[model samples]
Target: MKVIIAVLSAVLLHCTQAMAAAQTGFFIDAPITGIQYVTSSGIEGQTDQGAYQFSDGDVVDFYLGEGPSAFHLASVSAEKWVSPNSMTVTHTRTINMTRLLLAMSDFNKSDNILTVNQAKISQPAVQDFLGELNLIELDTLAQRYDIEIPSVGEAAAHLQSSYQYIKQSLSSDEIVYAPRDTELRDILIKTRNYQGHLCFYNVDEIDNPSYVGPVGSTTYKITNKGIFEYPDNGDRYGSNDGVIASCDVDLRAKRTEEEFHEVSSFEGWSGLFACALKGCTRTNLSGYVVEEYDSGNSYKYRANAMTFNPSTQIVLNKKQGLGQHEKVDGPNNAEFIWFTFASRDVTPLSFEGQWQEKQINKEGVSYRCLDIKQGQVWATPFSDSHCRARNSAGFKNASVEFGDMWWLQSSAKDLYFYHLNIPVAWKDSNQTQHYTTWEYLPVSDSLNNGILYRYQQILDEKDQSLRTSQVSELTKL
Candidate 1:
């Protein structure tokens, strides 16, 4: 939740003054009416991590979204804090929609509540607590007893809202950071409303509003369907042009964990990295280091997966050392923990868990599955319903969510270059693990692969500009 707080610092401000004008029809500080959920958890204890406990079928209404961006917690005592004494304190947090979706995802076990732009947010403790506040004990509760309940999906969303109450409250010294997205797999990040530069829209445009919207700006152009159009320096192309800019996507309602189709195609590591020297900075990665290979063997960069390489894959002896994270959406010092209030995690989502829950879907897949014999079959490593690799090449309406954390979409499809969040991981020669929140733009046409180009770019952070050092790539297991 530390990284989430930092992202929210900008997201809260951005959404407040987002493109929504007074005349535009959008909810502003609107209250979520009819807010109520199961009240108490009859079972009480702590998880292995020492978090508060709840019955498997507990009912709770942690808080309600007072508006599109504001939230209120009914009770703080039920939350997970390092200290149980901290629960007595009640507070409201200025969480942005991005982080809110993440919290809701873990709490509700659904990652598609809202669209994540560049990073993934996870608070396992939040999910654990909220998951308990469900209508599980409907027969026990008088309000729900003998009453027809909503379908699992509908109930899932409503029940997930219970996280508001149990969501952790950041202390005075607590700082928030974004959870890492990981490497080699295709990931997506949104450019709209973000301070980052895009193939068509650069930060200079915001600094100097010389031209309005996409057409007036000479820097880049947009298509009828919100796609960007541009001349390529090479043969690469999208939208029948050199490249295409797309939007961030939401996987909120696509599939369920009931052995459905696999949502993500690439099983390899997917993450972001920063290669710039001077003005560049990096910070705040979450979770533990996943020992992909046996600890004694360490890790290796293979032929198929490359985190920093644009085309030619390089081999790394151990994990390369990472510097500070370069600011992605906000200021260069994007990680300043000004917001004292930190959100507690309820329940964190696990990759293996998501994959296990994932069922197969064939609508947008690129590869034909030989695994499917007659009826829908559960996805296995061999028969996985992953998205086609080439289809990721220059996609038209593509979006991605890796490890259920980060989300990205193209700015426009026509542009030749892109600045994106690529996931990277490695162990230092010292045997220390390192995670990179890569936010580099590959040179023109280098990012044309529709399968998983993170996002479009501007002239300043172009692909041909920088040379990324070798780190590690996720090989196909």
Candidate 2:
């Protein structure tokens, strides 16, 4: 009897030891398999565009189980869209071992469903997508009068491919810490911000330049009025200063030494001339951006290459010192004429041929000319009418002794947008040594003439002030 009892004790002890040595693996109920446990907010019917995919906006559970278990369980949580602007846990806290073990056990679950209670998932996740109607919009303005609007692919293709173009810009390092989530969150917010206008309109193609007969070969003009931030605030449609922008796009333009390949590169434009004022280099240009933004919206272009003009080199530092109110440029003392345009995507669904034509004074504007892809906007008269219209200011601010103006110089009018800008540094006519990619343009009233007529404000509380005010106003008359 004594031997049997001793044997039973030894067997029980051995079983206990075996269990202790083995790493505890768990089976998660469907939802927690991926970081975005809830793919839809209850309001979604199926991709209503109002639906929510809580990948970035969701607060998810983080377990440090990539390697050996520390036996010490830590509870880390974060809000993807919050200010300190990171998904990392601000502080660490301890939780009951029982709850953590349950969460950790589900880590290895094959089922990818969010059956778990929404409350249990995390804190500050998106509860509803349509709940806040801060939707994105695309607008187009024909830059050239006789622009040969190119044939375009489907919206699904551009949108899908755009997703890839932006994804490629995010380096592996930006997401190494939390590999699964927050990788593309930066661009997502940027896209949200740029599209957050208060009131926008559907551009109508006009036959005649409202002011005169024929201005130039390129007669297309951009008329934008009141770009709103949210649907709710769009009610006050009459409050925005509209603009009429005319330009002629040259398809042959090329960009050089410009590395906006990443969204974060845009963020580096933190302070005033951080690069130009201090002198920038290819090596340090990457450091100039403070954060990566959704520059993709600016890239809704017709041409594959995003450039101001041929051979233009975007100086990383010239875009510095811009504030939320940077659009308000005082009387030009500066000749560099650094300007950025708030463009709405105007690409057409299909093209009959290169030259887009419409009856004069059409009710709606159709984007039929050179499709604007992305980047800051600069104007060089494409036609005699356009040239004369803008010439009201004076003679050429400067001369373009060099650049890819061969076609324009040789073309009929013997002219092209003389000023170079976008994808890099641009200069006004006064610049003699502007090609160094460090020169600033002369600050003229006309420099920002195109971007002068717009105001955007937010109406939704959720989208109003995540980390900063969701309001933006720009007047460059």
lDDT of each: 0.22, 0.21
Per residue, candidate 1 scores C-alpha lDDT tens digits across 1-477 of 999998999898776653231110101111121222222433322122122333222222233222222122222212212111111110001112212323332321342222221111123333222222211122222132232223322322332232222232222223222222211211122222122222122222222322111211111121122222222121111233313422212222122222212223222323222221111111111111111232343332111111112121111111111112332223211011000100121112111111111121112112221121112122223233443322122322111112111211122222211222322222333544333333222211222221111211112254212122221111111
RMSD of 2: 25.5
Model 1 steric clash total: 87
Query: Which candidate wins on lDDT?
Result: 1
In candidate 2, stretches whose alpha carbon ends up further than 4 angstroms from where it belongs are 1-205, 209-288, 291-477
Over 4 Å off in model 1, which ranges?
A: 1-53, 57-60, 64-243, 246-477
RMSD of each: 26.2, 25.5
1-477 per-residue lDDT for model 2 (tens digits): 999999999999987865453321111211133222121112111111111123221122232222111121211111211110011110000011212223322332242222223343332211111111111110111111221222222222222232232234321222111111111100000101122321111111112223210011111111122111211101111112333321211112212222212222323443212322233322222221222243554322111111111011221111111123223233211111122221221111211112211111112211111111121123332231211222222222122432222122222122111221111112335653121111112112222111111112223444432211111111122
Candidate 1 whole-model C-alpha lDDT, 0 to 1:
0.22
Q: State the displacement of the C-alpha of residue 371, model 2, in Å, after optimal TM-score superposition.
A: 26
Q: Please give the distance, in angstroms, between residue 410's alpha carbon in candidate 2 and its true position after superposition.
A: 34
